[model samples]
Target: MTDLCPRFEGAMGIISKRWVGLILFELLDGTKRFSEMESDLPISGRLLSDRLKMLEKEGIVERHIYSEFPVRIEYSLSEKGTALEPVIQEIQNWANDWVTPENAQKD
Candidate 1:
């Protein structure tokens, strides 16, 4: 027997981490500095650093360094990462429908 599901399992594995979704969501707005991400997300600095590294390795996020007094670093979504927007949106829509405040309160 063959598994019917397409093996998006690899891509799923990459984005399924706790902080990864918010990281991608933030990048959708535009590029952001490491400090900006750290401050915006609820994650610890070390965890954010690790997740950013992992996203970079997966080709979903690109990191750039600016030549300045303090040498700032920024992260933005790559082409592949931008492609995830629709998928994320659909997930949000589905959750909105099935996990409404009323529904949650009832449960």
Candidate 2:
């Protein structure tokens, strides 16, 4: 008898944060700016930045800085992050099937 896998726990630690799943889902389509992610998700800028930094550090997300007049920064999924699409999609499907609009959260 031994531990199954610490990697699974590590993954849960990453995705269990409130805004992380949404942020990954948002980035699934393509690259988006910080402002875009902020607007799309209901999370605060500070929290979003923190999550992005964590994901970047984990190699799940990639941040790109473009040299331009104003300087442009964008975020997109790395190969590791892209690999989560199926898992996220299944979660989305489960939510659609199980989470009723009446019981869901909204302001």
Candidate 3:
């Protein structure tokens, strides 16, 4: 059957991946370098790069490069991405209610 909530479906398609939420959560603090994100999320370099690119295309993330000897690049949440904070918080609250520490520990 066709999905009625196309907007939500599209958003879920982008943010429902395993690493996407962690990536966005990291950006919530501030901008971070590619290396910093890799260290924070502990994901492989290739997958992180791919997710960043997808988020950029979706207008939820921005990449900035500084001209330096080593060429530093950093990623930050776009305005659109910041708008998602409330939704993320609500999800967190919902999970807190239903997902007990005991259940979490089992997995």
Most TM-score-accurate candidate: 2
Alpha-carbon shift of residue 74 in model 1 (angstroms): 0.6
- Quick one: how many clashes does candidate 3 have? 0
The residue-by-residue lDDT of candidate 3 on 1-107, one tens digit each, is 87569888888888898789889989989999999989878689999999999999999999999999899999999999999898888877988999988776331
TM-score of each: 0.86, 0.92, 0.88
- Put down candidate 2 lDDT per residue, 51-73, tens digits, no spaces: 99999999999999999979999
Q: In candidate 2, what residue range of length 10 has the lowest lDDT sum?
A: 98-107
The global Cα lDDT (0 to 1) of model 1 is 0.87
Q: Model 1 — TM-score against the truth? A: 0.86
Candidate 1 per-residue lDDT over residues 1-107, each given as its tens digit: 96645557777778788779889988999999999988988889999999999999989999999899899899999998999999888877897878967665331
Q: Residue 69 of candidate 3: its Cα lDDT?
A: 84
Selected candidate, larger lDDT, 1 vs 3 = 3
Candidate 3: where is the Cα deviation over 4 Å?
1-3, 105-107
TM-score comparison, 2 vs 3, better candidate: 2
| Per-prediction tally of clashes | 0, 0, 0
Candidate 1 colliding pairs: none
